[model samples]
Target chain A: MKLLSIKFTNIEEEWKYEKIELFDLTLLVGVSGVGKTQILKSIHTLKEIAGGQSVNGIKWELEFQTLKGNKYLWLGEFETINSANELNPEFFIELGDLKEPKIISEQIFLNDKIIIDRNSEKFQFNGNEMPKLNSTESAIHILKEEHLIKDIYENFNLIILRDHTFKIVDLFDLNQYRIEKLKNQFKTFEEIKKSDLNTFHKLVLIYDVSKSAFEEIKSRFIEVFPQVENIRVAHNVINEHSNFDLETSLIQIKEKNVQKWIPHHKMSSGMFRTLLHTAEMYLWNEGTVILIDEFENGLGLNCIDVLTEDLIYENNKIQFIATSHHPYIINKIPYDYWKIVTRKGGIIKAFDAKDFDLGKSHHDRFMNLINHPFYKQGIS
Target chain B: MNLYFILKGEKTEVLLYPKWINYIIPHYKQVFLEKDVIENNFYIFSGGGIPSIYNHTINAIKNINDNPVFDKLIVCLDGEDIGIEERLQEIKKHIENSKVVLNPKCKIEFVIQNICIETWFLGNRKIVKKVPEGLMLREFIAHYNVNTNDPEELKKI
Candidate 1:
């Protein structure tokens, strides 16, 4: 599933519902304190909720489409009670666009059929009347109880949202869990090779070492660091005690000499960041949504070029939403992919860069619009 | 010819230079290839104020000499209570005493606006009559153009 657009309000007292349309590669750029990071954080929170966390008191109207060419529009409104931790959510889901959008009604549909309808205190689902649901819980929270809408619920679960975190200090500090996952994938490949069920096994190939994703990531990493000769998963022998196993597959770099392979911790900040980004970009499962705040944290101009190009043309399977403050990155990206954010009276707002009609040469026009705010600030 | 300019005023110079620069400096060949207004080949750098204009001019000359992109360096500044000859001599001495050598092929010229940049606008009798006395002409200069090249017309006001 791909998120097409979103409209949200009541965030930090911003009275208007700001709508942001996303593309394959969407980037948010603005001055500091303009709520660029806050937008990413809100999306990350929603993604976590979609992954089964209790929904919070943040109102949002979202539209997404599945791979099977089905569109779903959902509006969610949540209210906070006496305690800060408590939430009261009301959801409205529609299968497709209708002539009159039911803005003030609680409705849920599956394939153009009404599955759930809640009016004030009365609740009905699939023509059967049910007891009044708790005001503080979402209707989706009790989807298992019905059991009739299993396929629809499973389709909703397919929406994967992943937040990629980056910190300068932890750039090279390899996560143990990621290393173990890689080793397990390799072990799975070995197990499949040893099996002799030729008829069923020929139908599918679970994992092939030659087609390992690590090789592709290595090529991308080398593009950023041409001096990097090779990159591979190796075991770090500290005084010759431990062996190459699941807990640690240290990313080793061979630069000038094949004999001297520098481990992950020994890599520079720029090198480590480029390698980690390359690995994460290719490793994420297809159709996954990723949110990255300040994507060009430690990258140089050339590295940013490679990354933005990859985001624009290379990675179609994964959808990206990133925030950046660099003009070099902003100018290179197509203007249609930009969401220019701004703040006023402590309230933040965002609008698509294309809305300003920045002529054909978007880079020059974008700069002209941003530098002279009086010309475009009235857009919101 | 390739050229770099250093202007020592605020919006008055920034706004007026783009429209009037081609007529002000004669060293650049007037190659108005298109009828529509297009960006000039010359580069303009703001020197902040009168004093900084002198320092910025020298730095720009040295920078062009090091990289050798421009063939000429034109620095424009305001007389600002001092005579035009004194400011010219001050720049001449610095160019002669500099350890970093200037590019021999590159020629440097200094253009001093009498009193200040605003006085150039006041030089025009038509503009002086339109705005009230003692009012800043910064906003008025936004409509500046290349109409006349008469130095005597500019000197009368």
Candidate 2:
């Protein structure tokens, strides 16, 4: 479920909801505390809201649609699709475009009709105080006209964290337990094969990984990363009780030729971040959206530009969304993918490239903010 | 034609990013010299501001997050293919202005051309020695090795 776009309507210090295009790798750039990270976090929040879940922080109007048609648009009339068949297909949660967009303000709508009218706290059909869900009913089911959206709403996983924890959070913890669940859900016999990163391969293939093939993949990893000198694989070693998915170690290669074993932590922070980026890119090659905060934390200034080029340009397959303090990252990621936000008077304002002067690139805009205080500091 | 031949050593070789180094945005003043020459420069950082032709310069050049002045770029080392490619890169970027006079038997004795680019990058041409020219540096090193460590080695040649 790739995020197609986002819009903010009626938020303070900014205009009403407007469309902002997202690229394969989208960068959120603005002055410090100007709400750049907030834009990414809001995407997380909007996904939750569409699924009809609870969330904190500044509320926003949200609208989304799944690649599949919106069969979950209407609540009461949902069964008609099942009876008549194939009425609604696309499912999306356009935070600002949905029928019951959760804005702090009272009224919400789809196109024109009020989905959530403040005066009418409850939806028009219920005509009572807002129907608080019993931890089951999704707002996605409640607001739209179609009913099949429940599947789309149920599919997403929301990740919310402060700056330091982003790397650990985004990775899917395919521990031991989750693997059992998959087996219980659908049984199949696939021999457990060697090494870490290959677990992703083993489950996908359900076969043995030969010694030669193992080295082949390692060599591929080495082409991009020269630091890795050794590699090995261990299969079928999974925790029986954990909610663990298929987990293997594409871990540090320990070759008999090399006596010293250097743990990944021993590497420089910049190098560490690069490894994490590479691992994530390896997993989420396509639709999975990757969100990172402080992408340039420990990298050298020169490495920042090169790394940015590698991800936003070279590996343009997955959806990459990150917040960065380093200006050079902006120089490489592109001008349009950035969404500039400013915080003023306890309210955050979202601004796109069009809102500002045309000629200035996102990097130049960022440097401009650095020169001007009103745009620099981020919310700690 | 501007050419820059970095008398590269271990200190500079470590800074290369493997493949072709098409261009470098000038951010530090870099120089190249042989390895094993350690001294205290006005440079507060151990390797800071020391002139060297080597790979170890990666960490030192990176120390400039605090102080940056675009003075030098790309010192190289000659280690097998990696070393050779790095040296070739140096020749490619700094083949002009440095006035390189080569005595070799190769169609491509030396070249330093100014290619147009949108960004500010180092413009260097390489005195890419054909097989014969590369062979010459090898033979010259051996020729000088007889008294290579001595200052008077060139007089014997």
- C-alpha TM-scores of all predictions: 0.58, 0.47
Candidate 1: clashing residue pairs, number: 0
Worst 10 contiguous positions by lDDT, candidate 1 chain A: A196-205
State model 2's lDDT.
0.42
lDDT string, candidate 2, B119-142, tens digits: 012111122222334666668656
How far off is residue A278 in model 1, in Å?
2.1
Which clashing pairs does model 1 show?
none
Chain B TM-score of every predicted model: 0.67, 0.22
Model 1 lDDT at residue B118:
75
The regions of model 2 sitting more than 4 angstroms off are A2-24, A56-58, A69-138, A141-147, A158-220, A234-250, A254-257, A261-272, A300-307, A314-317, A354-380, B1-157
Task: Output the lDDT of residue A352, model 1.
Answer: 76
What is the lDDT, from 0 to 100, of the residue A104 in candidate 1?
25
DockQ of each candidate relative to the true complex: 0.04, 0.02
